[model samples]
Target: MYAAAGANARACSRRGRSLILPLRPLAWPAVTIRLGHSHEADDVFLFHALTAGKVDTGDLQIEPVVLDFQGLNDKASRGELEATTLSVHAYAYARKHYRLLRSGWTFGEGRGPMIVAREAMTAETLAAASIAVGGVTSSAYLAMTLWNPRARTRVLPFDKVLPAVETGLVDAGLMVHEEEMALELTGLVCVHDLGEWWSGKTDGLPLPLGSVVVRRDVDEDVQRQLHKAVSESVHYALANRQEVVTAVRGTVGGLEADLADDFLGRYITDLSLDIGDRGQSAAEEFLRRGCETGIIPDSLPLEFAPSAAAEPSSSARDGARS
Candidate 1:
């Protein structure tokens, strides 16, 4: 009798007769939201909960559009994605179409993109030499230009930047993402640390690297929902750090456990969970400098999505510590 009722119904006995009762609705039809992000470990760890169904997203069925940061930035420039991760530098151009989310921001407190070369060189020498950059629109590029506007740059894929440098295709490479970790192994030396330079320039303010933004045309209610969902996802991932780290390592090829852990420690901080006052200030200052240096075309006041009212749980707060 139970088998005959099928999976959607519950078997019950009524007056010694078999009765079939419909089961409660499991969930409402989910609204599909396309979220674009890089395929790096940090991004993978940040969204692990949402993509893996470890956290409730209400009615939202988040669809991950995995792309390189440059690709995601390009999509954001055209307002093609519902939500996307964008370089803070790219955000200067993309601000017309999207608003930043408080969560999902990566900041470098004392470290960031580096200019790596085959041999040690002075900043003055590096400024005049040809350098390979991950992307012209990337924050790293913006920082590089600001550090030395005369630096000759050629665009290459982020992953290819190192190889280009190794082969002497360029005098140095402006390295971002996990490529920084491979410096010693590749026999390259850091000529300049952009993040450290920026921090010193800004009087210790963090260097804004990347952030998630939502399309400006998205409904306010939906925007709020996305904000809440992403915030919760970050919190969930934080609360389950080890699990997320393990999962990210498995999914992102060549990402060893130690590397993943170190990357998360460097990036996924409280700032990653929410770009607080200092983070906002840092981003604004970074962009402002970009415009002043003529690297960025325009400057606009940074606008952020409304944050969820609920505070993070104790577990989340605890787990946020590196």
Candidate 2:
């Protein structure tokens, strides 16, 4: 899962210029991305555009090294990859280690996270058993803590959660990301959705989704370029989604094309790349509550970095599906 394509896509220079980037096949910077899962709109556009070579990585020569979003998050928090989509909870956790890239996005009010389990295991009957989750420090674990403070959740990678449960290694899973979609297919019924569970507890507001963050060490100019490139990619993906629905189908595997389209329509939203003001507020509120309940550390250093649209007319953004 760790593919560090070191120094291969290095920046190039041209005669009599500061550095004329060699962005072959692209007018913009050449980035080598280690893509995340298709469910995320953050990388959706970038993946689409990069594949189409519609936009360059940056003004100079940069390459994207996208990994699985979860894989990206793991590597990102450890300062491995440059940029990738992630959960807001992961963003909160990552801020302790990296600088946020920009206001990528969040799911609207109606779309929320769910904690599915085998039909037999109900929350009320949960015992002191292990709950498999993706990544020990992942948002799934965070949600599990929020859902049941007393639940014993064992953090594992996303791929391991379902298998762990199938083998009875854990009693439940606080799944997020692709697992949310794949959970039902596993034949291990869902017990709950922390997001749905959250809405019931917090009125109608949707559960906090995730965001995109980059390493603090990244060049500021490159960060800006990445922000622009990804934003446009998201915009384009949303506008021309009907086309890619088929291409993305094979990535998720075993899903009906129509169902994939429906999933994209439900999970992906207009604010796919910019969480803007409302997302920030919701994130802050989530952090406050999570901290208040002792679910997350009180001084976890979680913050909401302002976006380009922020400051001009600061107001809550409309809640849309992620």
C-alpha local distance difference test of each model: 0.82, 0.57
In angstroms, what RMSD does candidate 2 have relative to the true structure?
A: 10.8
Query: Compared to the true structure, candidate 2 yields what TM-score?
Result: 0.72
Off by over 4 Å in 1: 1-28, 309-322
Off by over 4 Å in 2: 1-46, 56-62, 101-103, 127-129, 298-322
| lDDT (Cα) of model 2 | 0.57
Poorest 10 consecutive residues of model 1 by lDDT? 313-322
Best by TM-score: 1
Per-residue lDDT, model 2, residue 293, is: 82
Clashing pairs in 1: none
lDDT of 2 by residue, 1-322 (tens): 1222363255445575554334344222233444343344334533575555665544334355545656666665676655666666666556655665444465535545555555566446765556776665555556667767787767676677778777777777666644555655788876666666666766655555666665565544445556666676677677777766655654445667666666666556755656656555556666677788876665344543333422111121111101
lDDT for 196 in candidate 1 is 93
TM-scores, all models, native as reference: 0.86, 0.72
TM-score of 1: 0.86
